[model samples]
Target: MAATLLFLFVFLSLYGSASCRLLQTPLLDHATTDPIDATQLPTSVEASPAQVQEVANVSRRELGYYTTSCETGNPIDDCWRCNANWESNRKKLAECAIGFGRDAVGGRDGEYYIVTDASDDDPVSPKPGTLRHAVIQSEPLWIIFDSDMNIVLKEELLMNSYKTIDGRGHEVHISHGPCITVQFVSNIIIHGIHVHDCKPAGNAMVRSSPTHYGYRTISDGDGISLFGARDVWVDHVSFARCTDGLFDAIMGSTAITVSNSFFTQHDKVMLLSHSDDYMADKTMQATIAFNHFGEGLVQRMPRCRHGFFEIVNNDYTHWEMYAIGGSADPTINSRGNRYTAPTNPFAKDVTMRMDTPESQWQSWDWHSEGDLFVNGAFFIPSGAGASSNYGKAASIGPKSSSLVGTMTANAGVLMCKAGSPC
Candidate 1:
């Protein structure tokens, strides 16, 4: 067949011109709430397991399994929402990131800030059009917000590195008090905001750049709290009640990507490890795409502990307890999701080996290929280990759970308008 389609187009053009060579690494060297500050953000970098299997084979050949068709068939929102000039190419949404955070180049090499003061009073001298002073500026930015606002932080809003808060066409809301604290530097990109009721502010002074400031403590209220972060990306955001965990990547966060977000009432709706013997979270790597786990969630749509995770095409209508859980040996790889099961009959099993004990987590690998399970939902997979560790949890390569409800139907925070075609 034409030499297997020219060897799959020369192996996806050398895996999209491979590149991810971080080295000068170091993490978890302090920050038990900033002792003397040096909360390790010296340009952090830690990606080796053969560079996370070559960035999970270049995010499974660029977020795999799409059979064409644009305008919301959701290939990262058709790579730019059919832009009628997406608010003047708002940094083209940082090149429409794909799995394994496709090198989150947020702030795409710097510029545009905006924000226009939404008041936080002072997390240590933050005042310029606030949002904590466009996330403690140092350089690269792309902030944008000037309209609908509601930011409310009295602490914990520390962020730095290449940024990109870009709350598309306004309606931004970093709710009820302290939230957002991506520690350690990295290319970050939190888009279209609406992070819910997060409380638990810090114990005092904060500020993460524009010449550092410190002295913090007491902060567990996560609405987005990735510590020791790496290239990250959270798109189309929205979350509900969160006194903790509405997205919590831990101590050794890796190339992450929480896409088309939207979570509900919440009770630990997301938490990618940093415990079970920290061990640098075994070089974490995430990619929970097209999210939507709506209405009163309870478990951890993401409760992983150790490493790789790539729950794809998400949409679990609701959950009361189990919708995907884990412990130390993490390596989940659920694909093309669509769970929907919660009449409580003991939470119809959607996997939760939390306190691990299936004779040692049945070897812990946990894979599920084209998921769908409606109503009496079920999924209890485990250990499908080597295919080279399932190619590092197969970053992404499934798109047929009946198209995951039109690719998560506008998953969240997308009310774009500036000449149409959002």
Candidate 2:
């Protein structure tokens, strides 16, 4: 009986060992299926949790995601993204991506490029057969109007897609028609340009309506009109003596940064409007910092909607009407803005007064509606005794008596003279 039991045990052990060996062998293992064709795999399979986790674990440095070197070798080097000489060689990298096994669609750069012209009458328009060839070109571009030449008309310079128009150390005068119009675009940058005297052409008065009246008037000609665009940056530019608003960015456009610019002599210096039928919620984010707003004989107002705006360290002086108008549900964080008036004319301090005295001031005062946010600021009233008489004086009054280190005052001066970090 013992011998028979031993023989049975040995047979069982041999069978178990053979089975384990077969499982261990790569050739015999059924779990090891053939390599997968990535293209053939379903999107769900490709984006499995395990694969996503693996990709997430990859450091940006390892993937060369934000590396300055990576921006180079594309069709257009977005110099704004990185400051490197290799950015100029982006076209080479794009060519390589297409010629090699890399995806063609993935090789595409941004929209726009920089065109250089030193002579007048040099047409910046696209070549024949390409009515708007330059328009469709997927590259962010700029035209450096040299000091030698003058641009007579820059109308219909429709910069669509991710693009920019940079005037490098030159003066561009758009006297006859609309200076520059940005329509149906995103991620744009316009800097260091001088735009002046752009007169509106056709149907200026016919399109008049309560909500859309100002948009089409002859005085509606603007230095820059950002219509249906997002994520725009306007820096170090000057708009002088315009018929309409110097810079007008309206129509649900969000994420705008306007800084280090000088604006003067316009009906409405910087008007941000949100009329009815505009689908965008009033709640957008805007940053207006270190800008000089003043020297206009007419009304200079900045109207906002439901947005959070940072109006900091701006030098505002000499305006006919309200300096800053926040009729929209705006959380205006006003800090360190200097309000100065000329000694002779002697203007009234910045006040939130309604046009109609009979109307409840609180109803018109958007701040009272629980949207305005003020911190660490100053208010120099119009007249000597007017400061004390103004209603809601306690609320609009500065929190801290000292202006030192409280507001972002003279920021432009700091940046220019001391070379401080901005």
Candidate closest to the true structure, highest TM-score: 2
lDDT of 2 at 353: 36
Clash number for each model:
1, 16
Give all candidates' CA lDDT scores.
Answer: 0.75, 0.42
- In candidate 2, what residue range of length 10 has the lowest lDDT sum? 368-377
Model 1 lDDT per residue over 1-422, tens place? 99999998887777544311112111111101111111211211222223221221121113322212235356677778876788988887787787788789978888888988888887888888887888788889888987998888888898888999988887989988879988988999998889999899777878788787989989988899888999999998988897888889888989999998878888888889778999898878888987878878889998898898878778777788898898888888776676767778899788898776799988888877667676567887777534355566555555655556556656778777788766
**Best-fitting candidate, measured by lDDT?**
1
lDDT for residue 132 in candidate 2, whole number 0-100:
29
For residue 403, give model 1's deviation from the true position in Å: 10
TM-score of each: 0.34, 0.53
Tens digits of lDDT, candidate 2, 227-323? 7666676655666776566777777766666655666677667766455335473645565654656465345446555454545445454566556
Q: What is the lDDT of residue 419 in candidate 2?
A: 22
